[model samples]
Target: AAALEAYDGHERVWCGRDEERGLVALVGIHNTALGPALGGTRVWPHESFEAGMTDVLRLSRGMTYKAAVAGLPFGGGKAVIIADPKKDKTEALLEAYAEMLVALDGQYYTGEDVGLTLADADFIRERAPNISGTSKGGSGNPSPVTAEGVFLGLKAALAHKSGSDRLAGVLVAVQGLGSVGWSLCEKLHAEGAELVVADIDTDAVDRAANTFGARMADAGDILFVEADILAPCALGGLFSSDTIPQLKAGIIAGAANNQLARHEDARLLMERGILYAPDYVINAGGLMNVAAELAPGGYNREATMRKVTEIPRTLTAIFQKADAEKRPTNEVASDIAMARIADKRS
Candidate 1:
């Protein structure tokens, strides 16, 4: 990082090509001093070039700290293939995408992300060498490990804020019940937390209600629910000015990244006594999990868990620095990460 003075140039290489399935966009090689750049390939519906660029760059930068904070040797990088996964998936399109990744010569490793799946990764892996996250035996989804990180992060945030690790009697409202959110809901339920579950998917809601016995609510109503913790495990920007006033939660910790609508959103939360676990820092478990697998065989799971759990530690340190220095925590954290990059570059 710029402050740590640990690495060299953070040169970003890219490949964008259009075929039958819209665009195959690839951004590669963030920093190699720690090692090659390994990250997931996310396919999403993007309306503009800016959307794709923002996602890849931010996700790449996140990978850096995700690996750094998780103590892995690899640096961070991510690829975004911009298109509607629902409308434009085809064998030919994926094959062309794989050909592009294969051209990278092991410089970039691709896996699964929001709009992508293991099957897609496997398709890409056939043509691209060095890509991973397709399990050898193919046992389960990565959402659980992702959920694990979020759960641990919530525990850390809970302990940091309330001085307790237990979630019993703690009221939690979870947004979305997708793979990761559903997994997180189970964890919260197991911890004895009172749960309010919401999802756009009726099937997912019904399943949670039947299996986990979670109370269901209208999806839009979840953000405004009165609760102890509001986990935005769905999409980003659920914490903007319009929704902040309606929030009754004391804590904002969940799997969603980029939850802030703008820089001022943090101040809003702080004013409301809602300690948000800086979206990227708290939900970094999936990144850490993949990075752990890429490390040498002796990768410590407990150490990895400790690393993810330390997110609150990093966050609290940032908040304390902000308070003493009279700056925003976002400013402080960005300054720290960029300083690490600058130091390393110099």
Candidate 2:
């Protein structure tokens, strides 16, 4: 009932329990006016059932806007299995989760997200056919595409701030060495950007340093580091009342979803002269990649990349509108996404 109160016009929400496998899952279909609702499956250890539901609700809504702004013929939906991936993930649990998705029919489709991977997607596909980002489907991993979009979005933010989009010689503080972060670091390094990388995972951090020559920073200090851009490629809510005042970076952009702890943080960053690339808009590359598989003539890598290339243009448009209206970029982005959803409803 509390979850329903927080629905935000969600089309449907389902909660399932698999006692046999000790699995609990929630699926939220935020919208489907454009087409079927599509998002990713996230498996994580949630403190409570409500927390897991909230995650699905929030992420599913983000997917709606992400698909709308990215011009995909899909709505937004998300699934979450409440368990620690390291210790709780078993083949039986994954298969049970897949069965839950199947029960929903074709209304929702899923791919990979945090705590889930392509291999997991493959496992889910055995029980559910409406899955994307499978190795068999030729989509491969979505991280590289996601990172590519973030790289371009960051460039657009840089152009908005300094009148030059060149990344060479620019200092970047990347606060996550995950797949997306690592790929983003590679792109930044290729463009000669000075990198300071950090992650809770020591191996990931070490790999970034060894592979890309990124200087290592402790996770606690990465947010406050004095750099031209702060790339949050990890968890959300890094920008808050306490951290906003401490941010020394001129621009905030990365692959992480929900970077702001609260909506008002957008205004705080704007007042501080920090340009932010709205998370969903900048991180739509994976969606773009998978949406290609649904293309009428089948997936084409070149065509899919062409769509991914439009991300910078989208960010530039948001920045332009924000400037014209004297509003935070986040607000502008929300307006754009909401307007599209409204249009479809109308």
- What TM-score does prediction 2 earn? 0.96
lDDT of 1 by residue, 1-346 (tens): 2112212244775876966545668675566556678777878877776667666766676666555544456777878888778787677778877877777767887677777777776776667766666655222245677788788778766776788979999988999888689889888988899888898889998998897788898998998888888888877757778888888888888887567766577888777777777766666666666666666673456766666666667767765777688665566766665556455567
lDDT of each: 0.72, 0.89
Write down the TM-score of every candidate: 0.84, 0.96
Tens-digit lDDT track of model 2 for 253-332: 99987688776789999999899999999999999998888768888888888899999999999999998898999899
> What lDDT score is found at residue 63 in candidate 1?
69
Candidate 2 local Cα displacement, residue 145, angstroms: 0.7
User: Which regions of candidate 2 fall more than 4 Å away from where they truly are?
Assistant: 1-6
Model 2: lowest-lDDT 10 consecutive positions? 1-10
